[model samples]
Target chain A: MSTVIDARDLTKEYKSTLALDAANFQIESGRIVGLIGPNGAGKTTALKAILGLTDFEGELSVLGMDPRHHRDRLMREVCFIADVAVLPRWMRVSEAIDFVEAVHPRFNRARCEHFLARTKLTPSQKVKQMSKGMIVQLHLALVMAIDARLLVLDEPTLGLDILYRKQFYQTLLEDYFDENKTIIVTTHQVEEIEHILTDLMFIRDGQIVLNTNMDDMGERFVELMTSAEHADAARALGPLDERHVFGKCVFLFDGVSREQLEPLGELRRPSVSDLFVATMKGTYE
Target chain B: MKTFSWLIKREFWEHRGSFFWAPVITACVMLALNLMGIITGEVFLRGHPSVMVDGTHLDMIGHYLTAEQLRQVGAGLDMSMLSVTGVLSTIMAIVVFFYCLGALYDDRRDRSILFWKSLPISDRDTVLSKVISATVLVPVITIVVGILAGLSMLVMVAITATFHGANLWTMLWTAPHPFQMIAHLLAMIPLIFLWALPTIGWLLLCSAAARSKPFLWALAVPVGAGIIVSWFSLMGVFNLSSTWFWQHIVARMLLSVFPGGWMAYDPSIFQHTESPMALYDSLSLGHMYASLVQPEFWVGAIAGIAMITLAIFMRGHRDDS
Candidate 1:
């Protein structure tokens, strides 16, 4: 796979804190990479740097161009929905489409209209009149209409209901994602996006703690649910995290073989959220 | 070029109320007032015929006045129409002043700056678009509306004069020097816009730089400096009155945007010469255009460009939101 984004020792410092600290990662084309971290963990900062919205100290390239010097040129191939409700409230739906169509060379007005036709949004509706779900749908329609190489979403479905959130990802997966495109997303709702993400990068304290593909996650990390009698034996295998559920001890282990874990208890693959929690807790670095 | 055009269109979209609607409303109100004044003047004239001495008003020095005096009276009426337009333009200037002060700052306050930045347009284009909207587009729109208002009022006055048994075309229209008046008004727009550049540039810079309360920030520094200069001068510390910062500031605020002090010149010429034609003749497009080569104009233009460049740089680098 070709790499779409490459960062080496990327760092951004604020007056009182270092938002991103020597962070290094790569996003290959055609992969939906989830950048998971708690609030203030520098997730937004990293995305801002990638989008050329902020300056940073390091070498970074998107689509083989340095974002700092060529931000406007770079924006032609990159699109982003920075957050929910970023659309101007006074702009009518039609004006938004016209504006994007006029300014963005790759934007397809017909495609955008087609996307909007699927929802209750009409040309006359202003952004302020739309509900949160409608706004997200509008934003998604505009984003998907752009023939961009990379789409970065930072909390795109924030403050929406579960129904809209589910529909948001569903529409993205169904209509937008393809082999030639790459998506990098960061959100607090990790589980909702876990199923669609091909790879995950866990960041904590401005550092990437874990970087691995979803397929490899099963082999590299295992969750063993064993009775209290065998919990000590499971613990001996260096489980990355331990918790109790219904009088049974659940231990998450990394890099321990399934055969070794099976003897201690029932083995299963840990969910991305559990893995994220374990990773953030510094149990496995 | 296309991106810049779209950016400019976006500014018009956002500021349609100030750039388009305010001047339209001003025109309509001025037209209404002119109509009311014409009716009242006609009633008062007919009811008081004795006030007309020797077939002309006693105040007009009887009927011994020559055609030159009659033409001057007609010109005086035309000057009133121009005054109406002047008032409208003042309103437009005020609208544009606050518009420039808030143009950059409002987007950041409302968090819509993100939407604008997400486009493929550069910061330089965005800043330039706002500047053009303030200096060029707004003034042009106001001028168009002012001209329309002035002409409509003149037509109304001519119709009212006809009802009063007076010759409409030669007396009302010809006396005003309509072509010269229009040419002078048209020339004033670019001159005033250039003269006001320093204020416009400073407002935009403050809009870009201030996190909150941009109005206060834009005003405080200049006002504070003026106060310091005055305090030092009063205390016999130095003779800095030659700097004329305070004089220029007041002029920019009141007089610079006007053409050749016409607002002040109008009433005085009308009082002394008692001929609106004399006032019309005094309104010189040549004098207004002559200021284009003045040192103050060049200094303000260069300073305005520098401030605007600083605003662009601030917009690009200061992404606190």
Candidate 2:
């Protein structure tokens, strides 16, 4: 598959803090990659660098062009929903559709109308009149109509409830994603998106701590739950993280085959949240 | 070109209230007041039984007035039509002034710039859209509304004149030169644009760069400079007086956004004339374009372009939202 984004030594500074430090990564097409990170961990900053919303020192290529200089041109092929409620409050629904259709050459008006028809939004309704979930729905309808190659979503569902968040990702996967498209999302609710993501990236302190495909990650990391009797043996295997749960000891092992871990305790595949917790452990301290 | 037109249309959609309704409301109020005045005048004259508005009144006017006096009355009627439009222009000036002040800043303050930037439009195009809105679009809309309002007032006056036993169509309406007045109004738009350019550029710059309260920033900077300049002049520190600096820099940067604010351009446009037609010709496009010959216009135009360029750069680079 062709690479959609390639970055080398991408660094950004804001006065005294380093927002991105020598970050290097490559994302190929047709993948849903979750950029999971804690607050101020350079997740949004990295997304900004890719979107050409800020100035950065780096050798970065998005869709075969430097996003910093060709931002307007790149925007034709790349779509983003920068948080929620970014749509102008004064705009009516019809005006928003008219404007996007006018400027975006790839915007499919019929598809946009199809999406809006599923919601309660009318053409005369102003954005300010909609609830937060409705606003996100309108925004999604607008973005989904555009035939873009790469979509960068930064905390797209940050303040949403479980139902809205679930519907957001469901709509995204069912209606928007395709073999020719790529999506990069960053959100604090890792569990909600963990199941949909094909690739996972964990960032800490302006660095990528772990980057791997979900299948490989599942094969390499195992969560072994054990009683107190086998806790010593699990520890002897040098598990990456150890925790106590409901009078039982759980040890997370990396790169240990199932046969080796089966003899010590119950072996199960680790969830992305569990691995993310293991990777980001001690960051707050 | 299609994208640019849509961008302008987007601006209209966003500011429908200030652009369309504000002028419409102002015109309605002025028209209503004049209609009320005419009705009351009719009632009061009728109440005074001797003050009859029949053929006798026409005979009295023809009997008491000379041809020169009758001609002056015709000029007065024409002047009244022009004057109502003059009011509409004032409201237009105020609307354009505040609109420019908030053009670049409001989106940033509300965090809506992100949505605007997400589209394929360039920062240059976005800023140029604003330039077109403040210069061409708003003024054109106001001019159309002004002409409509002027015609309504003239119609009301003709109705009252007809009631007074005069053929207003031949005697009054013919003297007004409505088409000439309309052409003159349309022609003045370009002058308004040039004179307003400096102020538009300065306000938009503040709107882009100010972190908070762009209004305060736009106001304090020029007024503050004027105070310091005047203080220095009071101390006799410079060869030129403070008025020169205030008129050349401060007023150009602030008050030029007001309609027909090229007052510094030739006060002789308002000079007493032999007739209302002469007065109309004095403020014609020829007299207005004469200001273009002066270096001040070019100096302000160039400075305005520089500030606007900087504003565009700031809007592109500064990602505070």
Candidate 3:
């Protein structure tokens, strides 16, 4: 598969703070990549660098073009939803749709209107009067209307309700996804998006600590729960991550087959959230 | 060209609600006030009087008396309401300025730069739209409102002047040269941009710089900086002369965007000692035009371009939200 986004030794510094440090990553085209990281883990910085939003060291490219040099062209195919709340507070829902229609040559007004109808939003209603959930729904509708090849969403569901959130990705998957389309989403709610993600990237402190495909993740990182004693034994088999819950210990092991890994403890499927928690705990070193 | 038209139209659609209604309300209030003044006999300055006959401005008493007997105007009005129309025009200009600033800050604050950046348009187009909105559109709207306002003034003046027995035909047809008034307005445009360019630049930068509350910082920080610097400059605590101040302001405002020489007039001209237009005319300031073509002006010009470039660069990459 061709790479849609590629970053090599990317570094970003703000005043005295190093926001990103030699971060290296790439996303294949026609795949949904979940970028899971905590706040200040440089997920935003990395995304911005890819978008050419800040001056940074190292090289980055999206769709084979540097964001700094080909921002307009890259942006034509690569759209982003930064924050839904600030989606032009003064604009009416229809006006916002009209704006997208005005700017994006590939924006489908009919699609936007249909999506708005699904959300039960009146086109003439001003966005300021809408609830936070409605704002996300509106933003999602507008973004999904664009025929962009790549969509980057940063904390897209930050304040959205569970119903809207489910409806959003569901709509995104149903209407927006195609063979040429790719989506990179960064959210802490890993499990909610895990099913839609073809690839999962675990970032920590501005570095991609783990980059694994969903199928590979499911195979390689077998979550084995055991007594506290077997946890140390499980760590011996190349532990990728581990965490404690009550008095029980769970471990994620690398290069250990499920059949053989089962001997160490009680093997269970690791959810993306469990993996994220284990990664954060630094137990799966 | 279609994209540019779309940009202008989008601005109109988004802002037209506020832009249109605000002026219409002001216009209604102005027309009402003028109609009130026309009914009463108080439509003139304390020493000077005027009024409108049909569409024509007439100053003679016979014409105003002829017109007065025919109409009651509004609210049992009198001449004292003439100033209301003048106030309306000034209010309109102020409102337009604020509106332009708000429009400039809107995309940045909304992070809708993402939306625009994704389009087939350039940063130049994006930045130029704002410059046009502020320097051209806002001012053009203000001028139109001013003309409407000027009409109101002329009507009131003609009414009172005619009431006081002045010549009506001369007031409308033989009035002072309209061309000269137009020329004065044309001259004011560059000067207005020169004075406010820094503020404009600041707004554009802040829009890209902040994720939230962009305008407050965009407006406040610069005015704050200008005040602080001017205070120090006044107290002899800073060595930068007014000439240097103008140069810096010009550098920051117009940097790299266009001919830096745009603001390269002689320092003495800005002094209220003489009106800028009179100074421009008397000095045959072809020298001022010559100054703009210089390398120094180019350097300042480069700065303006660089600031815009920096803003685009920041806007393309940064994720404030």
Per-residue CA lDDT of model 3 for B1-321, tens digit only, reads: 666766776666666745555656776676766567566534343444444433323343454444343222211122213233335435544554455445545666656655555455777677666655655555555555655555555555555555557643353445343333434444444544444454455556666566667657755664566676666675354655744654566244423122122443445334443543343343223434444444444554355446556665555555553
Native-contact fraction for each model? 0.68, 0.76, 0.56
**How does residue B225 of candidate 2 score in lDDT?**
93
Please, what are the lDDT tens digits per residue for candidate 3 over residues A44-91?
888877776667889898899988777767777888877666576677
Q: Using DockQ as the measure, what is the rank order of every candidate, best first? A: 2, 1, 3
The 0-to-1 C-alpha lDDT of every candidate, in the order given, reads 0.80, 0.85, 0.65
After superposition, candidate 1 runs with Cα above 4 Å error: A282-285, B50-67, B70-74, B170-176, B234-239, B249-280
Writing each residue's lDDT as its tens digit, candidate 2 over B234-287 gives: 535557788888888888988787777775566677775785667856766688
What's each prediction's TM-score?
A: 0.92, 0.94, 0.74
Worst 10 residues of 2 chain B by lDDT: B50-59
Compose the digit string of candidate 1's lDDT tens values, residues A1-285: 799999999999999999999999999999999999988899999988888889999989999988887888899999998888788888989999999999999999999999999999999999999998898899899989999999999998899999999999999999999999999999999989999999999988888988999999888999999999998888788888999999999999989888887878788889999988877885334
Residue B153 CA displacement from its true place in model 2, Å: 0.8
DockQ of each: 0.74, 0.83, 0.37
